[model samples]
Target: MPVQRRIFGRPIPAMSPRRMAVLLGTIAIFAVLTLVFTLPSSIPAGPSLGKFTDHKISLPKLKHIPSPSILNPFRQAAHAPPVQKNSTNGESSWYSNWNWLSPFSSSVTLDENRSLLPPLPDRPPIYTYYDHTIEKEQELKDAENAVLLTWRKAWWAQGFKPIILSPAEAMNNPLYTELQMKQLEAPMMTEMSKWLAWENMGTGMLCHYLTLPMGSNEDPLLTFLRHGEYPMLTRFDNLGSGLFAGSKADITAAVKKALANPELKAAKDFISAVPPETFEIDPKHDALAYYNDETVADKYPKIAGDIVGNGAKGLLVLNQLMISHLHGTWQNIFNRGIAVVKPHPDHMSYAVHPARRLAEFLAQCPESPMPSSCPPNRPKCKPCVASTPLKISTPPAYRNTSDLYTIGTVPHPYTMAVLTAFRDDISIPWIRRESPRDPWVTALTKELLGTGVSGAPRVIKFKEAVASQYGTAHSLWITAEGDMPDDLDWHFGFAIPRNATDNGRSETPVPGPERRPPVEHDFKDGPVPTEAELEKEKALLKRAKEFGEARTADEEKIRGAIEAWNLADTEAWKFARAFLARSSVERKKWEEEEKKYAGGAGAERGKSEGWGRWFDD
Candidate 1:
């Protein structure tokens, strides 16, 4: 009989189920390389496995060996493994697009390539972390698989690899909230302690995450951790050896430098370690306490010193102004009263929140929540009360008496300098004849805060305008909360113009803590105005000064009484008139295009020429 044809092409197939299954299994085994288990070191002496080309492997020359037992899979215990940097191709290459934007630019060197940042180094892995976004899913998945595969590959060994780190924010992450992080950190620290007991990694070595200490540029802790790596490991560990870069290095160096100064870290290591100081999170008590205790040290007394000392002087002028604005000064009695306002940038929760919250309270309110303060009559107010919004009053009123005009290009020296330069064209010289009945100026007495769209430029137009009845250099005051980079230019393009009078008019120009934008008198530059052009500034000062001081003192007393009564009344307006002498003008001008465009973008991203013009009225 002819062999029965099965289906396709007349082939008679009569086989046992086992044989058929074996044939299909062999095909699958050769076709895909997705098996988690190890491939034998060698294959049978024949052609080669499916898709095995010369570029991939020379299987014919390879030795054959039995793979790991399937039943015994996952039975091996492995050390924590390092990550590897491997290129993906083959099928993946089909989906890959050739996109290359080197963040390091072409000028990168081997040192730059090697100098890496420590990625979110919380002690415990962020698997248990909240705030996971879709952007992180791929990275998290890839990292997990890579970690697992590395351990699987080595049977029971560990591994690690190098990678560049980006800014924590753009890096697509929210650090673990302190409470939740402590949950994981406690366990990690405990496990580490036990691991040390079992493996005896010495006390010289540490396993904490890369966290800097509070209120300090020097991180003795980090320096100690990095330096200890050499002594602990018999084999090399890149993770332990070079875990910090940039500012971290600066901090470590500063720690060593400060230690060498015969004060901190001088007598003993253990003793020099940060001590537990009892302190409140309240800004007033904290500022006072911190300043006092901090002053005990001569060299590195306290970070608070920056606030109370230089900051304190500014605070004095500001306090007087607030006092005058609240009660004593009659400037705003008919509804045009002035007050001081501050714009604060928020801070990280775990590490810096308490400091910020405290600082804000101290700044806007008196040192005591009670109305009784320095000047007897100044009214006290709640930190967040709505008494009035005055000019931004964290001060040496913004002035640019600097020589910022040599032809050159360098990063501006901080936000202060930038705003100082921008000051020339940005402020309102004086308001035109608005009524005392105008709601904002008269009734509400509110000052406008700089409100630029997030990621957009700061641009706005003033309605009716007036020339400064005060002076030509229209500088003002401000207060910023976050970091003010050293490169920020507090006195850039807007050099305070020379007076038409004698140069002895050496007044302190506009000043604010590094990055905060200062208040502006908001006017223009012509040949410097002459003394003949001056308004009655002397009479204005004499009349305004004593009244300002007395009113400030009285307002201080009233503030104390108000605080004692648990009222929200504030002294913002009383002092505002005494300090601020700006007259915003109505004008058609395009000034500070960069500021208009600078929504916190870095160097290249900042605005172009700062001058543009609108139609003149």
Candidate 2:
């Protein structure tokens, strides 16, 4: 309150002259600094609103950008300079007056000092190897060597690599077709039997006769007889068509040629002494014809005689029907006839036979050649035997009595019967159908070998063959029964000796009379049968036995009746053989008589004059 000054109608104190001068100087200095710093920043050429404004202000207007030309920089016209029409040369020029204006353009100068390149040569063929003809000759020679080796192996009964048929070949194969036809019901049953045979043979059993197509080149019969050892012949002639045309010399020559191969030198013994009796079927008759004819025995010697003559020690005629069809060949060979045994209808079809038991025994005693002596201390495996051996003129069963003192005793050569527990009829369409559960030999073998026996027929056969002493017998006699069905399950059985002495017998003690062993049945996957069930099974077996006996009796009667017919056949055959033996002599005599009659001209004149001319008159 010293002095009050009015600023805007209010009283206030006034400042001194010095203070006023200071305030004025401060305001002037601030104004000068703002003008110097802000003038340049406020110019419209470049302006920025960074950190200065407080009041609203108008923004500066922006100028419009110029429209650019649409011409493409990469255009053909842009890449090269225009041609100078007034110049002497017609070539284009690269130099331009304004080329430096473009930042993307190169600074290097372009020149027209280029020349054309030479043309390329023509292309050669893609493939050109012309030595196949020479290579084929080498391949053929290699094949010959392989064949020679295989032939020697087969001769040794070492088995052979089976001929694998192509899909096309299999479909047309006659043997395969027959197999299909025969096993249509149990389509895989035959295969199962074959596997069993193969297994048995491999383990300890004797060599088996495998059914093969007649014309197959790979057949063991043919392999030994004709083509396998003959490298020069690419293909063998079919049997019976003209098998006898070639002489023994030709066979010897083939053997010699085969031995010439260095690879086969070690096999000379096999080639040189290949048993002449290796071929069982006579080459004079067609195989199909001989198999079908029942009178073959009557026309020739008995089938057993033929077998023995061909060096067979023992013959197992399993298909009794087939043998019976040949009149009395079964009785003549084995001294007994087999009757068919029908299986229970409700029972699942399976294979059970003495042969299977023999196979099992063989599998168990793989190292032992004689199944009876296996394990040494085990009960001597007793086998079924015929009451007496047949007295044949051909040859007696070979005997090897030296081993009797060493290995206890050996039984006389005998043929045991192996009966199947299945229905023989498969001709009916309904019976032929099968399911996946039905056992297939190949599939069963793979499954059993891989995972052990799962109750498959193959496994069962192996087990049975191992458990039984049936192999102790010389051969097996398999029987079939009932209405001889055409589609029978693998009805034939044969066992071939691996060595020349297969029929040889030791001086072993003779087997006692036939006696039934106590049955020791064990269940692998099911409970044992009740007393009633056991009784029922026994009754069923009794009925089956009675039926079998009745059938056997009937068969015996039929055989007796047929025996008379066989005698007639024998007489006829005897007459025919006797006539044939003197055919040449008779023909010579007839020719001589004709010549003598022609020479007698007086008799011819008398005959012409007497009745012939008079009767006509």
Candidate 3:
């Protein structure tokens, strides 16, 4: 059997238990040693043990770095370090052998020092400031009221009855209220102050506010004062046919109704003649007739001396008329002898000047006679004259003369000239330069104080003085209406026929401030304007004057043309004249159209016509 097994070659025999055990143990030991040698150690490379661990090598110091001992795993000084007393200096510190940890915590670190805020006072500073402002406003109000009171007393004493409107009633019309009127007065007040100061120094002038009433007799202010009523509100008619609320009839009716009130009657009883001392001369006796009787020189006085007195010797006739109207009771106030009702443009009696009509005709005349220029019998022979018959009438009992002519609706160009001169020479300059704290104002204030006048009276003395010098102090109409205290409605259009609309009627003009709108100013709190700003303002005013002058010049041209055209008797001229003779609305439209057509023909014609060129260069 052994010999046969030998043939299988190398067949393994079963080992003994002891030998197998020993071999298994030895193999286990060898596997364990190999695994132990191949596995990596858990320790990481320390910061100092890396490439930077070379002798004398240094690492850059990083900014804003945190403590290293606290972050280092090798160091365990994160908590409290061992405390040790300094043997040499008797000082105590937490770090003894450990050099990294700080003795104190981060909470106690004092790196940067800064100032601390002081404790606030019991009362805030803002409250004090507010109180001061309120007090100041009250003081100003008191001062203003005092001056107004003094003025009222002085005027009342001088036999000037207050044309006071009910504040509550005036409240209905925004323009008439006290507060609103004050806004309008603000600029005037500044001028008034300057004027007053100048007056205190003996520079006599007149204020615009003092010279005019709150409104003209035709304005609603009269109705409001006389009747405590407003007229029926009508729609704004482009045709201009609608009756104005403040008509004579309305005023008369209001006056009649108002007479029933005993309070008004009692107030009327107080009316008396002004004192002699109130004026330099007997104003009523020396009054010059402005409309017809006298020229400006005849009505006004020449200077008493070579130096020329600062003021006129006597009151103007128109001013006297205005005053008389104010002084008279409602019963006799609107008497025809004194106050004639300004006629409405829609009335048949409303007439244009014949000269104006003639000028218009001549302006339309062709250089060479057209078919219409000459009649059939006299073809191309002579220029035709457009005939306009004058309406002749006998003078009424009120008139001294019987041959009175109807005045044209055209306002004289002199008014425009005067307005321009005033604006450029006086108003604009005053507005830009006037200030309440001006030297003049200070001087006046001192003078007032010297006279034992203080508070509002002292302040108001300035207003009074200004009124005498620059304002219409002669105008005694006192309105509670604040917005339009000047008694002017500046928004009204020109009353000329050329400005008429296309509705075959003229616009109802309001008798407000006759001059151009004034520049806005704040003499109270506004900063003084620079030279550049003043110059700009002056330029604007100049432009305004230019515009006004241009309009006036255009009106003059139109009037001249109308006169010339009226003289031409040609059929075309007659027909054109007939069209113009129609309502002002129609005529204005025709004139505008004529100018437009004429402007296209030649530059000379274009340059000659002025009516339709308000915006044109």
What's the lDDT for all of these models? 0.22, 0.25, 0.25
Instruction: Name the candidate that leads on TM-score.
Output: 2
What is the per-residue lDDT of model 3 for residues 1-617, given as tens digits with 9 covering 90 to 100? 44323335776676779999999999999999877876545446467456645668568876664565544568743433333322111111112122111221221221111101111112100000001112234444343222222222222222122211112222333223322333423333332222222222221112111222222233343223234222332112221111112333432333233333334322311111112121222112111111112222232223112112222222222223223222221112122211111111111111111222222212221221121222111222333222321222211111211122121121112222222233333233232344121222223245235534323333233323212211122111110100111101111100012222222233233212332232222121223345465454445434433443465755555434332222211111111112112212322333345333212111111121333221111
Query: Cα miss at 609, model 3 (Å)?
Result: 9.7
TM for every model, in the order presented, reads: 0.16, 0.19, 0.14
Worst 10 residues of 1 by lDDT: 458-467
Which stretches in model 2 have alpha-carbon errors above 4 Å? 1-356, 366-517, 522-535, 548-617
Better of 1 and 2 by TM-score: 2
Alpha carbon lDDT of residue 478, candidate 2? 25
lDDT per residue as tens, model 1, 104-217: 111111121121111211121100011122244443434333222221211100011111111222222222132123333343423222222212211222111111011111
**Model 2, span 1-617: residue lDDT tens:** 45565889988777789999999999999999999999987776523444345457888854552212223355342343443322121121222232222211122222221111111111110100011112234344343223222222222221222221112322333334433443322323322223222222221111111211122223344334433232222111222211221223343343334323344323322222233343233332222112212222333233435433232221222122122222121122233222111121122111111222222221121111122221111122232222222221101111212111000011100000111122222122222232112122223134225434342333233222211122111222222111111111111111111111112332212222232232233222223445464444444433433444454655445333332222322122222222222222322343345334212211111111211111110
Please give the lDDT score at residue 131 for candidate 1.
19
